[model samples]
Target: MASVVNNVVAAVANASNDEAVCGICLDALDRKRSVTLKPCNHQFHRTCALQWAESVRPDIDRPCCLCRSSVREMVGRNGRRVVRSYPFEEEELDMKRQVLEGLLNEGDSFLISLNNTRDQIRKMLKESEIERAIAEKQRQPDEYVVDIDQEGAKLEKRKHAIDNLLEYGATITALGDAATVACAISRELEALNRSNSDLASEEEDGHYAAEQSHNEDTDSDSDSGSEEEIR
Candidate 1:
């Protein structure tokens, strides 16, 4: 842990004044007193980083505040490696913190879209009577039709939403929350598709039955007329 903090020297002190601001403290390095995390370069105030690292005590693999990666070494502008040589190996520091500051907060923007999808699916299945579509087709078998435009819109929305979720899950640094959300949304989409397929199949069957019935009636009438003519 000390070695990680010791690596917090100003690697780019000459670059710009803004470059010297510590991510945690959000302030400039006090009197060239800075450190940079490595083997990749990121500078912070020595005390700011040491305090942050020290807070992680027993967990040496604590993530840096700037980028959620575990901290290992910090370096100075002069490229000198720093280490805690003092007797202070594990000085205890206590502070209550939210777990990684809720590394993917619950109220994330992504969740809003997920919730909307869920609601839409629920309303379609529970509120909207899909069976009506089948009934309508049965009543007018010759002109059996569903709103193709509406169906296409629903399909497009589901595809776009699911695609976004899968892509986001793939690219995210942390996949736990993202994967869970994606799976839940995917399941909802599957339910919607199944509902639509069943509705469409029923409608087709109704149309076929109506067509057969109409054909049978027409044949019976034609036979009656022929028998009268023969008499």
Candidate 2:
């Protein structure tokens, strides 16, 4: 009977030793690795603590394992400050922590890509606006040049018409001056012809009076000689 009692005590000691070891590899804790203890005084590898918590749960409402104090405190790097009756399992806690870290990293990368895309679109829009303004500025000079050329053409035509009118007026004035000179010469010649005609009529009337006086003197001398013969 004493031998049987000794075997039972040895079995209990071995079980106690196994409980103190890490749950994942069932290995003894080295000095380099830290051990996490639950509220139940159960110890495990720090890496295996989270895994145990997720696997041995009653439901999602009970997020922690029976060994952990509470769900919120179970996954933290440091153990819970206030100890409770129940706690999280080692395996469940490790898996939960890894999943959370992966999601956080993915979210950070997505935000960075979104910001870069927005910046590229804004730069493209600004460049397009600048190009449109430059094109409009370039067209403005061409429109102005066309307007100036049209105005110059109108001014040149008006100048040509004015020159033609001036030349025609000078030619008409010269013709009028020649006509006035010819009229003056014709009036002077008519006055000289009237004076010559009056002089010729006066000379012919004086010669006719001298011939009648000579004929009357000859008749008187013949009568006087006949009276003297009768006596």
Candidate 3:
């Protein structure tokens, strides 16, 4: 009896290992217990399917699986069709991808804008620093102060500093605008990162299947272009 049981277990294991199924759909069990079996005999990777279900239906009262007619019927008892509750479709995924790409482009543009603004701010700061240094030099009771044109020189320097202060104020306003844009871009990038991570955890092939790599490359190119604009 023990030998018979061992043979049966081996056969089941072999069948599971040889099984071919879509990792995304989780239709067939590729390995024994790779996915837990429902009481209804429907199978899914325990973690993968549960996360997918949660995303589709946050309420636990909703049907547990979308792959079976029985599960649909169960959900229908509560006056909700399972299909209506889980509205994830291929078009929706495409929409999400497009949204992510848009966000990435926006981020890159904002970063470039901020960099330009920062450069202007640095130039203004440097001019201010130079003016301060020259003012200190004039205050020193040196022989240069006795020069006939020293007073005029000092007045010129003072006027230049005043003009630069006005320019600095304008630059500061530009910097503020850039900062606000950068903050918005940061939030968008963070959201995209979260979505990418969530998609990644679905399965080993989830990123590839979703074309995430291709999207990332496109985003990178956009970012590089922004960097070039900054330069």
For candidate 2, lDDT tens digit of each residue in 152-203?
3433443343333233223222223434423432332233234335445663
For model 1, the superposed segments whose C-alpha errors exceed 4 Å read: 1-19, 85-231
Cα deviation of 211 in candidate 3 (Å)?
40
Per-model C-alpha lDDT, please?
A: 0.45, 0.37, 0.39
Top candidate when judged by TM-score against the true structure = 1
Off by over 4 Å in 3: 1-28, 31-33, 64-231
Model 2 CA lDDT for position 54: 38
lDDT of 2: 0.37
For model 3, the run of ten residues with the poorest summed lDDT = 76-85
**How well does candidate 1 score on lDDT at residue 51?**
61
Looking at model 1, residue 225 earns an lDDT score of: 24
Rank candidates, lDDT, best first: 1, 3, 2
- Model 3's C-alpha root-mean-square deviation from the true structure amounts to 30.1
Error of 1 at 227 (Å): 99
Q: What's the lDDT for residue 84 in model 3?
A: 17
